[model samples]
Target chain A: MTNQEDQFYITKILEGDSSYYTHLVNRYKNLVYSIVLRMLKNEDDAHEVAQDVFVKVYTSLASFKGDAKFSTWIYKIAYHKCLDALKKKKRNFDTVSIDATYEIGIDQVENGLGQLETAERKEIINKAILSLKEDYAAILTLYYFEELSLKEITKVVGGTLDNVKIKLYRGRKMLFGILKKQLDPETLAIYERGTK
Target chain B: MKEEQNKEMEALSKKLFKEVELQSPDSNFEFKVMEQISSLPIPGSMAKYKAPFSKWVIPITIITLIGSILLILLFGTGNQYDIMSKLPSFNFEAISSPLQRIPKTVIFAMLALAVLLFAQIPILKVTFKNRWH
Candidate 1:
């Protein structure tokens, strides 16, 4: 969405018309919810966290300076909230090691996944993301899911662009190792086709 | 050996990263967020205009400060002569002497103290007066 349109909705919401938030919620709900679900690895926790994320965004909307995109700002909030929920649940993230059983399930999951096959890949991808160190996972989520440029990701994550690049490099390496365990040769071929 | 091996690994890594995409939530998700938000206390509910307690606190503090100063001035010092007169060697002349009646040192100290104390009253009153009707 354009900056001008965001400012318009902001003004309306600030003027005691909170229903204006529904438009923003509709626009980014999927993006926000996906990030939360991926990080928490539970639908119930993800749903609760997603609702809290939007409420926080609504309350803090007046402070939204246009320094970054609206999506970037909202994802920053969603990302933090999701991580907080994950910590509350006491999930582990010390070091990531992949299990080969994930490899066996790939063939079975591939046929049943249908159009959601990509989504199933996302679920596995989320496990990989959650296994990463907190700071590295944050950088990867902001970069890949939010589709933010390094400069924009720097502003959102409050890190130097060089740090963002280094973390992305490390995150991709770690993710590759994790995904290789879950992805069969067919999916790996499909992934290759996209890059080609 | 190292150069060819590194290039192949890079190709494989990028291939894996591209295979994943985001999964959308179940269809009922939006309705659930809406329901949750609706049940929350309305945003800005705490922002209603009212005279803050801090506003009243400022005046009350000023008044208490000034009142304590005035009470100290009124009651802090009393007649030393009256107490001293009860002593056997205390002469009526010593007690009733012109010097005793009004000491320049005492008068100067009282006047100076009163001037300083009274000086603060106007500034305090002016600040407190503005706070209320």
Candidate 2:
């Protein structure tokens, strides 16, 4: 929904028609979930953190001044909630290798994207996205997956646009290396069919 | 040739991540999100009406009280004639007889209650101020 549309629901909520908030929650659910999942790997944890993200959005709705798109604002909150949860658990994002858990599936990835289900293809892409460091992964998801501009990303990641641009550049390079390393030659060829 | 190869590499990498998978939560996700939102106290509710309540109010009142007491104590010890000399005083002839008829018991009770209140109020004020901190 547009900012004006979100504002209509927020006004209704502040005026006591709090049930109108359900639309806002449903609207951003997937976006928030995707970002949270990238930040924290576990599905169960992502689900729980997504709930906190919405509740935070609902409670803090009054402070949203339409300065940024509703998507960026909510994403910012979700990003922060994930960071805070990480800190509380003393899980250092800097040191934890996100790609360490996965067995690199060279055989399957080499099979080529010949007739893979649309959903399965995305699932493979997600595995490749996970190979970067956490910050890089998040930025990659926001820029490529979420289609957020560097300005909007700066809002979510709390850094200057230059920093986000740098991350996006480096993150793209890292994803290239990781995917190249994990995918067999034939599959990589199919995935890169249109380019050059 | 070098620039061309670099461009080709960048293009190839771009194609791989171009169609990113947007991962979503389970189907009942909205309902679950609503459940949590329902449990939370509404925004601004927690901070309701909690003004700083003027920290100086108690101190200023206390200082004014002590100043008043000091002024009263200083003048109360003077001889009646010396006090009367400062202002021309005429006794209220009409209320003089009624004052004598007041019961000593009632007067002593009022005096005791006043003393207790005056003694306890400063202590109560201090305790109340500390609770805010």
Candidate 3:
């Protein structure tokens, strides 16, 4: 929905017709759920945290001054809620170093990706994203999947634009590195020969 | 050369991400959220206002502590005369003589009750904040 449309429902809800909130919730559920799931990496936890995000959004709707898009605002809430859940669970993911990411050539990753079926490619990408550190995974998701610009992402992730840019740059490389690792040499060789 | 490769990588990643479907919550996700929202107090409704207990705690504590210390000084020891002599303008005996008639056991019990009540404020504040949030 457009920001104007969002503001319309927000106005109605603020005027005490709270049923209009269902519209807002329906609009952003998938977007919010996707981000939460990507960060927490657990379906059950994602479900719970996503719901909490909406309930929080509903309760705090009065404070939303329309300074940012509703999507960005909800994303900020989802991001922090996921962090809280991760902190509570004390779960950590192995972060691939930037040097390691750089060592893997992009041409090799692209060549390997060209060999996989679309479904396989999708699975590999999703799994690779889920394996990265939370901040990198979240930044990549926000930038690539949600199509939020670096500035909007900064607002959601709460850092300088340069910091987000660095994360995005490194995150994309890390994702390519992970994807290359997931594609076995045999599969790439077979597909490469088939293409030739 | 590096910039061209980075551009290619960006394009490839974007194309791949477009295929990554959003993970949906359960079918009842919206219903569950709405149910929770319905139970919430409507904005601007006459929801019972709960002032944080901690805000009142400081002043109440200061008053309680001062009152207790004065009571102890006036009755807990033989130093009532010393305190009274210092505040000669005030008639301390009139206040202390009547309070002294109360049994020492009752006085101590009241003081203990006040202490317990103040201690419970923090625990109760935390409980209420947790429940509300």
Candidate 4:
């Protein structure tokens, strides 16, 4: 939905019409879940955090004065909730280790070699993203995954514009190093093709 | 590190990063959230609205307002002419009769009740609908 349509439904929802919020949810669910999933790295945790974020948005709609885009604000809420969940799990400020023990046989990749390649590449990128400090991961996710501009990212991450830029520069470098080390050459070639 | 080389590397990293696929959520995820929200007590109902703090404030405000009105009425009865000279007056012909005076108190009470009811409405709907279900 367009921002204007979203604002209209948000107004309706805030006016004690909770049913209309489902429209807002349906529109943004995939994007919001994607961000939370990246940050949390656990499907169950991501789902819980995303839901909490929306419920928070529903409750706090009265206070949203359109000072920033609704997407930026909602993302900020989701980002913070994911961070909070990580903290609660005692997993904050540390990289999530990918357990080799959880790896299945090649039959698990029976869907296709293409999917297998993509999954292997994703594991590397996910590892890289998780390896970065929370602050850097947050800005990177906001910028790359959510496609938020620097100004909006500053607002979402509660940092200055220069801080966001500095983090983005450093975060990308750190992620690249991790990716090159973790992904095999064929997987990297496949990734390059998919991007182009 | 050379600046141009760093920029090129950053661009390549960004390009490679874009290849990361989205992790699909489990099918029953929305149901999990819905269940959680459904379990929460809805806001602004009688039990919450009638908390001791709000209950105290409502009655005290009404009493204070009524007291102020009585004081004004008593003082006006005693020194109506003098006070009329000293104070900026709203024309009392707009309120022609003593019978008309009673409605002012009723109006104040109604206004107070309206404010309370308005405050209570959100809480009521939030709480009641869930209970009814």
Q: What DockQ would candidate 1 receive versus the native complex?
A: 0.15
Stretches of candidate 1 off by over 4 Å are: A94-135, A183-196, B1-19, B39-133
DockQ scores for all predicted structures: 0.15, 0.24, 0.33, 0.14
Model 1, CA-based lDDT: 0.62
lDDT of 4 by residue, A1-196 (tens): 4789889987775545556666777767777887787677677777778888878876677678887789888888987887788788987545533332333222212222244556675666677776776667777877776678998998887868998887787666666555545545575456556657
Tell me each candidate's TM-score: 0.57, 0.62, 0.72, 0.62
Each model's lDDT:
0.62, 0.66, 0.79, 0.65
Comparing to the true complex, what docking class would candidate 1 get?
A: incorrect
On DockQ, the stronger of 1 and 3 is: 3
State which candidate has the highest DockQ: 3
Instruction: Name model 2 segments beyond 4 Å from true.
Output: A92-120, A185-196, B1-20, B52-133
Preferred candidate (DockQ higher): 2 or 3: 3
What is candidate 2's lDDT per residue for A83-194, written digit by digit as tens? 8877777765432232433443332343454346666766666776755676887887777667787888998999898988777766655565565465557655665563
Q: Could you list the CA RMSD of all candidates, in the order they appear?
A: 13.2, 10.8, 7.9, 12.5
What's the TM for model 2?
Answer: 0.62
Which pairs clash inside model 4?
A: B44-B123
- What interface RMSD does every candidate have? 6.1, 5.5, 3.0, 5.7
Runs of candidate 3 with Cα error greater than 4 angstroms are: A98-101, A191-196, B44-133
**lDDT of each residue in A9-112, candidate 3, tens digit only:** 99987776778989988989998998888888889999999999999998888889998999999999999999999989998767665563266666667778
Whichever of 1 and 2 has more TM-score, that candidate is: 2
Candidate 4 DockQ score? 0.14
Give the CAPRI rating of model 4.
incorrect
